[model samples]
Target: MAFFGFKDIDKLSEVDMAIYRYIVDHDEQVPYMRVRDLATGAHASNSSVMRFIHKIGYSSFPEFKVSFQTENQDLKNSNDDILTMFTRDAFPNDIEKTIKLVAHLMLDADNIIFIGMGASGAIAEYASRQAASLGFNCYAMKDPYYPLVQQLHNTSNNVLVTLSVSGKTIELVEMLNNFVNSADTVLTSITGNIESPIARIGRYALSYNVEETRIHKYYDLTSQVPAVYLVDGLLKELHNQDVARRIN
Candidate 1:
């Protein structure tokens, strides 16, 4: 429930960032951290802390505390962990841990082959660039048919991040069936509904808990928007990993 190391919040100046971090870490304590209380704890004038809060996009300490707590209200298992951001949840503390694994696998792979189909193939390409900037070699397997085989043959030190929202792509399922499991590692980002065949094939499936399937007027899969959040979580984990490596 605490801030995810406040990466976005840290972009602000040091003083403003400190206050955001404090509110995030001690939201429950803030019902008590009044102007007088902040003055004592931060050893800065109440005016200074109040000013810092607004600079970082909060109206006042009380309002900020309320917003923080509300955002983090459901502390335990959300029925749909994929729909809810699990790292922000309290149940599986391993959400961040899993994300870190994904980022690390992407970063450390000598030759990473990402297998994805349909819209997820675009997601794979975008993720490839994100990892490349971090100094990892990534190749997004473009076509669901042949490109995957070619890409796989090119790289043995591979991490296959196969993405399927339905987890029922026939070719993807078949590929998962015939492909010799790579010795390196395999990660999946799929809506792990129990009946999903793709979920059954994946080594480690990153569950994207999409809430409901509705016939939108445009017929678009709006639920997949949460895939962006999964990518964001993965990037945060990578950033944390980079910070830890530098600190060590």
Candidate 2:
């Protein structure tokens, strides 16, 4: 299941395991079922159901249900179908607002630092190269242990953009933590889960809220397309701002 991996499953207690199995068995009915319903079906209490949801990285039952429904829908549709739905229905006003705001920050900042690990790292690299092509001083930091913050002398002039699908990567979180007390630095994040740790640290956060997918319990197969779209939007916004400035 997309909800929990083998590592997460091994950490579950007996009661939690029962709840997990119940969820897997009743996957179709889960999105429609209430917490009490799941508790009853799993022979566990409502609190146990809530705890299971938290253990699986979701903050609430509704969040878990929404993610579950999205995952199910994704499985039922082809890649083309998913793309059609996204293009037709996605990109609400809040995302546009965040994009505009981040674009302003990018345009004002003297430097942009894009950081991520693994798949997100690749996305960060793409963003850095794209921004650099447009004449923005940008760097992509894929190395988790790189002393990124220490190398910067002027935090106020730097916009730190972090890309993460989970928003819970230890290295990325640690990197953000270093900047948490530095109010002068503008921290921006694009993540799949907005309520995640890295999201909380960001001064501005944009979440696509897509269903996360993984393979072999370790390889993250979660689509980065949403994040990429956000980056593209940000870059385009930056370009528009530059054009308007030149015109003025």
TM values, all candidates: 0.54, 0.65
Question: Which candidate wins on TM-score?
Answer: 2
Local error of candidate 2 at residue 149 (angstroms) = 1.9
Deviation in angstroms for 97 in model 1?
Answer: 2.4
Alpha carbon lDDT of residue 90, candidate 2? 49
Q: After superposition, how far is residue 171 of candidate 1 from its true place, in Å?
A: 1.5
lDDT tens digits, residues 166-227, model 2? 89999889878888877567888999888899889888997876767788999998878889
Top-lDDT structure, candidate number: 2
lDDT of 1 at 8: 59
Model 2, which residues run further than 4 Å from truth? 1-92
Model 2 residue 222 CA deviation in Å: 0.6
- Per-residue error for 54 in candidate 2, Å, reads 59
| lDDT of every predicted structure (CA atoms) | 0.63, 0.86
